[model samples]
Target: MTANSQMVTIKGTRDGLTLRLNDQCSFDSILEELYDKLSVNGVDDGQPMIRVTIQLGKRYLTMDQKEMLKRIIREKQKLVVEHIESDVITKEEAFAWKENSEITPIVRTIRSGQLIEVKGDLLLLGDVNPGGKVIATGNIFIIGHLRGIAHAGFDGNEEAVISASYMKPNQLRIAGQLSRAPDQDAEGVYIECGFIDKQDDAIRISPLQDVLKQKPDLVSFERRMLNG
Candidate 1:
C-alpha cells in the first residue's frame, strides 16, 4: 500500500504486484526500490514472487528484473521482425518509430569530416565549413553560413528543403539532384537555390524577394520550421 523512496509506487494487484517508477529517476534506483518492495512483501519464504511486468507509457516491458533494467535505459529503441505479426504495438513498435523518425533542429555546426544524421527537419546556427557534411532525412536549415556540403532527403524524401542565411555552399543535394553555389549573390536570404524542376536537371538560384511577394505565407519559414 505504501510507496518507497517517494520515487516508485508499489501496488498489489489481483494477479500479483505492480511497480510504477518515475521516468526521471535512473534504472538503478528503480531496481533497488523494486527489491525493497519485494522484501517488504515477504514473498520469498513460502509464497512465490509476484509476476511483475513494467508498463512504460503504452508499451509493456516483460522480462526478469535484471534484463528489464537494462532495457529501461534504452527504452527508446524499436525492434522489427519481417515475419512476426501482432496487432498491439509493443515497446518494439515505439522503438521502431523512434529509429525511423526524423530528428529536429541541429543547434550547432558540424566540424570538419563530422557526419550528422538526423531523421526530421534539421537546423544549424553556425557555419558548416569545408569537409563538414550534414545529412538529414527532412528539411535542412542553416542560420549562419554554409560553406561545406549538406544533403537533404537522405532517405528518399522528395519534399525536403535546404535553407541557409548565407547560401554559399560547396555542394548541396536534395532527393536525387545535386547543386553547387553560383558565382553571383552573396547577401540576403536565399530560398530559391534548389532544384526547381523535376526534369531537365538544373539548379537555379533566385532571390527570395520575388517569391515572398507572391506567397506571403511561405516567407515565415523560421516560425514554421523551428519548434520552439
Candidate 2:
C-alpha cells in the first residue's frame, strides 16, 4: 500500500466521517499524513459541521497527543469530533476493568453485625444473618438465605441487582433506592431478586427467573462459571 494509505485511512460514514489511524505506523507519520490529507480536502466554511470519529486501532495516545489530534481536526472549522475509539488501555484501566467485571465469591456465612463488601459483583455461598450487611458495587448473588441488609450497586449503579435463595432480607438496597421485605410469613419463600424499578425508581422484588428478562448481561457471568 502507498505510504499515505498506510498511515491514515479516511472514510465517509452515514453519520459523518471516520478517521482510522494505522496502529503500526509512527505517531509522527500519522500526524504528517493526517495534516496533509485534511489540508488537501478540508471541509469548506459554507458546509455544515461534520461529526468526526477517530479510531486508533490498538494504538495508545497520551492526553497531549489526543488533544493535538483534536486540534488538528478542529482547525478545519467545519469538522467536530464526535468521539475517539481505541483498543489499547493503560495498566490501571485494565486493572479497574478486571476488578469491575470479575465476580468475587465468598463461602462464609455473615453473622450479626458483620459486614462484607466487594468492589465488584459478590457471590456468597452462605447466608447473611439479621443485623449483617453485604455490599457490592455490582450485583450481589446469595446462594443461601439473606435476612440481613443487602446493598447492590452501592456506588449508584441503578442497574445492579440482588438475588437470594431465601429472599427475606431486613433491607434491600439497589443504588439509592431501599425497600424492606414485606411483613408476611416466610414459609413459602423461594429464590427472589431485587432491583430498581425503572417506572417508580423504587426497589422491587420478583422471582429470580425474571432477572433473565430484565438483565441479560447476567448470562455472561454464567458463561464465565461454565467456562472456568
Candidate 3:
C-alpha cells in the first residue's frame, strides 16, 4: 500500500529473512526505503541476529554499490547479510562464460617440453609426447596418444573429462584431483577416459565406452557424415 512497501518486500523464511528489492525503482529510492524500513522496525538489543538474503531481480550493481548496500545492512547490527543474489551479470563475465563453453580444435603433435592451453574444451588430433603438457578449462579429447600430461578443467571445473586414444599419460588431472598412470606393458588398444569420481572425489580411468554411462551429456550424434 505504501511506496516503501512496494519498493522493498521483506519476507521471513525458516532460514532467515529475504529482502526482495524492486528492480524497477532507482537504487537511491530503494536505499532510502530500506533505511526507513530498518529504522521503523527497530530491533531490541536482546533479540538474536537475523540473517538476511537480498535478491535483486535483473538489476546489476557495481562493486561500490554492492559494498554500500552491504554496509547499510550491517549498520543495522541486528541484521546480518548472508548473501546477495542478482540475475544480471557483467559483459566480461558473459564473454568468459561463452568462451569457456566452446570447443577448440587443434592439429599438432605436442612434443616434449611443449605446453598447449585452451580456455574451453580441447580436441587434439595429434599425440602428446613424453614431457608434453596440455591444459584446458573444459574437457580434453585427444585422437592420438597422450603420453605426457593432460589437465582438464584447469580452472576448477570438476565435471571436465580427458579422453585419449592411447591412455598412457604420465599424469592426468581433472580440476584439483590428479592421478598417475600405472606402468603398462603395451599401449591401449581402445580409447580411455579419465574423470573425477563424485563419490570419493578420486580420479578414475575407464574405457571410452563407459563414458556413455558416466557422462551421457558428452555423447552426441548431431554431426552427420557426408559421402564424397
1-228, model 1: which lDDT tens digit per residue? Answer: 334435567565775544455656665676676556444544333544334434443223344643655443223222111121223466776785555453465677777898887876676778888889988876677777778888887787665667777788889888777889888767665544343344555544455565345335444455654644
Give the alpha carbon lDDT tens digit for every residue of 96-154 in model 2: 97888778999999999999999988999999999999999999999999999999998
TM-score ranking, high to low: 3, 2, 1
Off by over 4 Å in 1: 1-103, 188-195, 199-201, 208-228
Candidate 3: give its CA RMSD in angstroms.
Answer: 5.1
Model 2 residue 17 lDDT? Answer: 93
lDDT ranking from best to worst? 2, 3, 1
TM-score for candidate 2, please give it: 0.66
Summarize candidate 3's per-residue lDDT along 1-228 as a digit string, tens digits.
Answer: 775559898899999999999999799998998888887887889999999999999999998998888888878659888889999999899999878877778999999999999998898999999999999999999999999999999999998999988888989999999998767644546888999888878998888788769788775411311110
**TM-score, each model?**
0.48, 0.66, 0.70
Of the candidates shown, which would achieve the greatest TM-score relative to the real structure? 3
